[model samples]
Target: MTVALATSLGDDALILGQRLAEWCGHAPTLEVDLALANIGLDLLGQAQFFLGAAGAAEGQGRDADTLAYRRREDEFRNCLLVEQPNGDFARTIARQFLFSTWQALLFPDLAQSAAPAIAAIAQKAAKEVAYHARFAAEWVVRLGDGTSESHRRMADGLAWCWRFTDELFMDDTAKFRPEWDSHINATLTQAGLATPKPVRGITGGRHGRHTEHLGHILSALQYLQRVYPDATW
Candidate 1:
């Protein structure tokens, strides 16, 4: 269960990190672009640590490289929200706010997990995610309450992102992960951010079903590896 949970969380970070990297040069402003890049790097670093630990815990020869570069699309465990394209600045901010908020809540609880290794990763990741959540919350408020144009875009972005919010809270695994849902809601509420009600949507990422974007993302992310199977940097 420790290995499985850690791997799933790592996959979430990996996929979302790739998606955020897509905005490196395309964000609306230089500052926002740099901010997203920093977040992407943070996620990537977390993915490496978590996936590596998961592999070790599972007693598998596989490591982060194998898990990240060689996994098939259907084997990825990222939520659908992360794989969605970075539509607009507001859309990106909305996605960040929602995911970071969820991660912030989830990690702190996981930090106390019965699994020591998992708890360690969660403890370390919780700190980084706290900052990420703050960054996202600030952007959400700035855009949401900004000028008329910014407000409109932020609202539209929130609407688009709201649909995916349901999947985050649905734990079909019955793992009974304690306090995960309530913790997230309370944090977001305190921050004056609202997440959509926990209505189930098409949810299978944790079970290895992924969005169509996963294939495309894998193609690009693994291109160098695929092209030069025997080469290393």
Candidate 2:
């Protein structure tokens, strides 16, 4: 359970960091571009810590880079939400808003985990994700209550993001749901958007059943390592 838990957390951060890094040079403004880059760096750091802990726990001689770059799609255990494409600014914000809010609630409790390494990672992550949630929420409200086009786009993005949310709470993270919903509801209300009613969401990412996007991500992520065959700088 400890290994699986840490691996999952690491995978989530790694994949989402990659997704955010995609916006590094492409955001609508330079300010947004830098913000996404910094956020991606933060997540990458968290991924390193958690995956390093997992590798240590597994006693397989694998390190963070090995676990991150060597794993196949079926071996990855990240949640489905983080793997979704960054469709538009609104879509990206919706995904971040949803996932960050959950992370904000989750890491506080994770700081209490019995595994001291995991607990320490969670302790530091709690502060980072609080800012992440707030950043995303500010955009959520700005776009959701903005001009007609922005409002429509924000609503559409939220609808796409909403289904994957159920999967976030499906595992041990279920304990955080009440707080998650409360924060989500308040944010949406403030944004002038309706709180989406619960529905049966797509699952299986946690068990290594992933969408097609992950395969593409891995091909790019692992290419250098695979080509070099463990060559290091």
Please write out the lDDT profile of model 2 over residues 28-117, one tens digit for every residue. 999999999999999999999999999999999999999998889999999999999999999999999999999888888889864898
Per TM-score, the best of the predicted structures is: 2
Tens digit of per-residue lDDT, candidate 1, span 1-233:
87777788898899889999999898888998899999999999989988998889878698888888888888787788888888888888888987887888778878876488878888988998999988987877777666788877776776787777666776643343244456545544553555554444667777778778779999999888788874676
Which stretches in model 2 have alpha-carbon errors above 4 Å?
none
Error of 2 at 195 (Å): 1.7
Cα shift from native, residue 29, model 2 (Å): 0.2
TM-scores of all models? 0.88, 0.97
**In terms of TM-score, how similar is model 2 to the real structure?**
0.97
Worst 10 residues of 1 by lDDT: 172-181
Error of 2 at 78 (Å): 0.2
How far off is model 1, as Cα RMSD? 3.0
